[model samples]
Target: MTAPDPTTAIDPVTAAVIQGALETIAVEMGHKLMRMSHSSIIRESEDFGAALTDPTGSQLCECRMSTPLQSGPIPGYVRHILKVVAGRGDAIRPGDVIMHNDPYGGASHGPDVAFCVPVFHQDALVGFSVTTAHHLDIGALTPGSCGIVDAVDTYAEGLQFKAIKVYEAGRRVDPVWQILEANLRAPQLVVGDMEAQIMAARIGAARFSELIETWGLAAITAAHDDLIAYSERLMREAIRALPDGEYRAVTHLDGYLDDPDPGRRDLPLVVTLRIAADTLEVDLTGTAPQLPDKPINMPFEGTVDCAIWLTVRSILLDSVTFGHIPQNAGLTRQIRIVAPKGCLANPDFPAPVIARFCPGNQLADTVMKALAQVAPDRVSAGIGNLRVASFSGLKDGRHWVHMEILEGSYGGRQGLDGMDAVDTLYANTRNNPIEDIEMHLPLRVTRYELREDAVAPGRWRGGIGTVREFTFLSDGGFSMEGDGHSHRPWGHDGGADGLTASVTLVPADGAPRALVSKIPYLKAKAGDRLVCLGPCGGGYGDPLARDPEAVLHDLREGLLGPEAAFADYGVAAMPAGLDEAATRAERGRRIVSPPS
Candidate 1:
């Protein structure tokens, strides 16, 4: 007997039904993980993703709430797992669950644990169900297994698992769980989260099996093939619409550990995009060399995934087009990536990657900027990068790790103002609620509000970042991992640049002191206050051309100060309304000789 040809086209109605059913399974898997997880990071912030893939590890569908960064890499992660198991001559069974967190083994980072289970129909492997979530503790130098800026290599980062089986034949592997538990600070939470992932994978596999049983394997496989082909066609059509040309842009990371002043050193990331007919390619040949001691390096496969995501988001923003296009391997049919070896984006082995999010976000921003040269109306200005801060310590003889993702402003687009105090790009994880933080850890929320006057003024004003301050209830240490400190977010079309990010530590009886953007650790006593100020987003269009009414509204809302209104927008701060004549005179004067 021979296998049925997958190229046989299925009815469009059946194909759409199967596609929707697969997507629902992925969503249910994520909901299961969230409901059963022990960590607040997974339950509250929702830092997880779930997906379904074919037997060869090609993604079929993903959960709607999954992070783009995580979902993009699911296929690669699954392929890596299959290869590893094949080398050992191990047979993957329906009840088996595989787990890994090694960055070199196709994971996003050490903290993001991935679990995959083989979905079988009639004792034959048909597909895989996958789930990935950020665990709070992974036995790293820090509590959250991240924000380590000074780590020299992967050994200091955390415990790494390279494609190991955590369950077999529907039974938990006690030894594997024991070894993981022995190394983690919060063993109970870690094991609980791992079990939650396993449960999610199981749910996914079971649901997929039911679909196969109901519809038969031949029809389902045909539908899968048709869906992938349809998406590839759509992606190619989208790419063909762009003019054939080369677009290039450059951006920089703020700090390196080896420099005399880490803040003063700038690491460049250059991107060149080539579009021809129906294909697009991104080359990162001249990017900065990998840092030996800093934790800013990213894995090559993860970097490629980030590039693919940016391209999809930029070209397919419409609901009708995006809805029909499958979020799978087909999306990459028209994209090619060239990342040079040993660059920061594709670093060599042994380099620390706990802080890779900084460079990853910058890569996405750089690609958008390059595309903006040709599609100015379709692209937005630069956005403030993600700033992750972690607070951890021992309390009541138990360890507590509180990792918070501070929200940054997004750049304003052609006709729309940027979103205010929100997560941008790859760092779209939700902000941890103040009440949740206070209830779970030894900290008090002091301030949580938008930074005033931090937005860049333009025709469409950029969004402002937020300020989050915390007072310690007990002695603990804090670690900062992010970028966008020395360099400001760039504005487009003659708009003004946005503000940079900063951290301030104020003692109870002493003055405030500035801290570096990336810190291995900073000890603080009870009653000390730590404030995290996020960077603002860049604006779109000229600030001088901003409407007086918009400027006045900003004034009333406290986002734009009186001084900034007069200096950037040439608008007078009047008691009742704008001084129309004074505004006209100021605009005319500026038009004669624009401020350089």
Candidate 2:
């Protein structure tokens, strides 16, 4: 593990001030990108992250709007770019920006477009501002990068751009633009969004240079070093808080429907976390074999790094005693990863990985579950996996795709219940507004409402799930992909399980049709509708321990219906015409649970 010199110190006030300035710049960069970008993912879903990196490629800070995953592997990505550029460490000139999407070559998932812009001062490279946004259309083999789940190679996944300069000497590279534009379905939109990325990088570079001007080069560099050191120290302290031992965990993925190989069953991902004196090691040695035909493999290092961040963040946020560890590269110093070759985490060439996030989130879940054994009070039950439902086809002679990324509820904790209708982990983005969807695409939200009695029953009831129904204006097709249906979100500490997710389509026929995990291309005529119900959160504690008054409150708010009140919380409702005294008498006759 890298260590910061103990002799060096930064004033608390100065550190806070620098952090605030960097945060402000990050927010501004995001705003600039969103304002200029043409992609719906950028302007609406906001499926991107931004950060400022030191000259050495180390992440200095991430903005509040940015995600921890975005900052985790950026240093790796930068180093990979340098290697591909023929060891030209200093060749990255001022006003030049590089872009790449080689996941195997140390980038994020296939659809996440990344750019690194070098900052120069006095003709010397000072730092690099990196930004990555999820492009809705990246000229993939399949439209919107959906389908092609049975792909056999990276080429089938999408086009791969090696580490190349997209901008040089403040001018956009003509050849790069021509090639990208020629291959994409929406050429103008792609080029426009790429330009937006360049602008965002420029914004970050200018802000960073301004900071240097305000606080001489020496002071800024010292501050950067101090920040890294402080983060490492705090992370080590957090590690010390955990018991020293080896803990093993494992999670399974819903097998791909397109895999021709019949021998493979549901893919199981194994994760082992070793907590030592000052370091935490995550090993994926015993993980399942890589699937050459399924789109679920991930770069080993990226997965391990992201999993560690999620687990550590959950502990800090949920713990009674949290630490001050900075969410930057310094936190990574105390964490080590080992992903053996040919495993799901470290697949070889030709492994389809368009849907790597499935196993990635599962890996995080397994690690967190293992950590919960040692720190039960600080951890909650499992959350419903990310549900990515997409609708795509030609609408009014123009091709479009609409994705409803549902953020299901989180698991409940020892003292409190889990959050509902919100994904609390990686890609905590919002659902695209119905208004935006209808206006941009050929779909309308027919019905959007909360699912009734769809929560897991417990003393502390699990969160209720939600449902979204959509109808098509044209006879387009739809597809749904996700997990946590066959396997509901699991509870902990004698808690109850959460409800599983379900999807159904309403036709202009006899009855609503139910769909499976992986839906093929199904044509939806006009007046036809699709309904999606996301999973509920797992419950914490015994159901009988919940207060009756709380149950009544949930009943009043309509979060819990009468059936759930009686079945899950063991609370019966009073008669409609009963007075308070009569209701109390009736309650006294039926309330048999202990004090909560």
Candidate 3:
């Protein structure tokens, strides 16, 4: 940031206009990348990020379509890129696109690669335009990247590109491109995606330069600087609203349930929020120790920090209250994060973190659970964690890989019911369309719908999870990383706990068998089927406080059985409309003599 001349200070109108323009440029970059990408994960599921950052590596604007996990770590990527470049005694030049995916440095995982382009005006560095996406394969032990649950170390995950220039001074670096293509399993698709990211980042850079040209560089800088301060002020005010105290909560993840070692499964994620006047601190001191051989450990910069900040931002300055505050670095200025070294949230280097997606998300859920003590109205009940599956197989001497993000349910809150069958917390990814899956891959979606009678009862009922059944059209292998199998989403107030997730394997002709939540790459027959049952969300308020009419509505939709209506909510059902007299009597009876 440059010194602001008192005579020509930027007005609020100009600052707001500049902020909106930067956001639009980011959104455009995201659209271009998605349109030009080859893999279903990027094009269909939209698992990518595009953002603009200042020369000092502070985020200015991010694409709204991108997930929090992807965009939130961009500044860290740029900062670490600068560190790596400086350590190697190299300079960033115009037309040079640097590729980075070092988990220990800033990346969320080994699979989410970032392509960063430095923007310059008149041969002076001004900002950076970057795009990051989750690749299908990175030449790991297996064909796919998402479900590499058994990776022993970071070296086993895949290729690691740290500050490598794919394009240097307008010249193509053929060797870097060649090395990438030769290593990946799906070379054509992965390379195509990387090229698309390059073009999109370049487009973002061009748009940023255009803005600087339209409004002088000083004016642009002044506007953003003022904007950042305004955001900080908003956050500080939000912090002041909460009572000063320490709030704590604990949640668990089903880390390697099949492992014989007890330390590998049912791992705990502990969070404590310390609030004082206008500042807050998040400490992950009680989290489980790092799993040396597992890839479930989260990176402190990319995964762990993003998880905490995303939850705090969502809870404090919610859209309804703040009315679309600009997402910049200032919002996090007043928040501090502390995680004990060697814990799951902050692991040592070379601890494999390729499969950190689900556990990182559960960490976000844990933060929400902790903050709920102070901000009850601004939070939800315990959320059902998500699952990811990588489906891969060979056909006619070639390989095809697909990464699917299974949706999870949200717990009910305040006056609203929990969202049903959607990606919860920081893993905000779209579900792959059934047509896209069957048309492009050798798979069949036999069943896709809401689970029957899966409602979590409350005044505002919790969300319902979906049941997905996938059958292999040909012989293939699949692996999954997920949680919420051993634990249920915690209920709020007097609400009941939510349901748990499970997976069932049914062979072509043999008896069906139950499987753990996380699955390693395993062979399957052509006619074998896998049934995924999603966890139901936890309810908010008391189930007895729910309206009888709402219970009748769920009954009509086949979401609740007659026995459940009477037992869970104490609402008797009849053949006609509602047995109001019976419901009143039952509720009164329960109020007088509560059931354990």
- Local distance difference test, per candidate? 0.82, 0.72, 0.91
Deviation (Å) of 340 in candidate 2: 2.4
Clashes of 2: 3
User: Model 1 scores what on Cα lDDT?
Assistant: 0.82
Question: TM-score of the candidate numbered 2?
Answer: 0.90
Give the alpha carbon lDDT tens digit for every residue of 160-226 in model 2: 8767898887787899888887777565566777788878988998999999899766666666777
lDDT of 3 by residue, 466-500 (tens): 89999999999999888889999988887777899
What TM-score do all the candidates reach, one by one?
0.95, 0.90, 0.98
Provide the lDDT at 491 for model 1: 91
Residue 82 error, candidate 1, Å: 0.6
lDDT at position 63, candidate 2: 58
Give the per-residue lDDT of model 1 (tens digit) for 236-311: 8877888899989998888653369654379888999899998888888788888877778888775446654655
* Best-performing candidate as measured by TM-score: 3
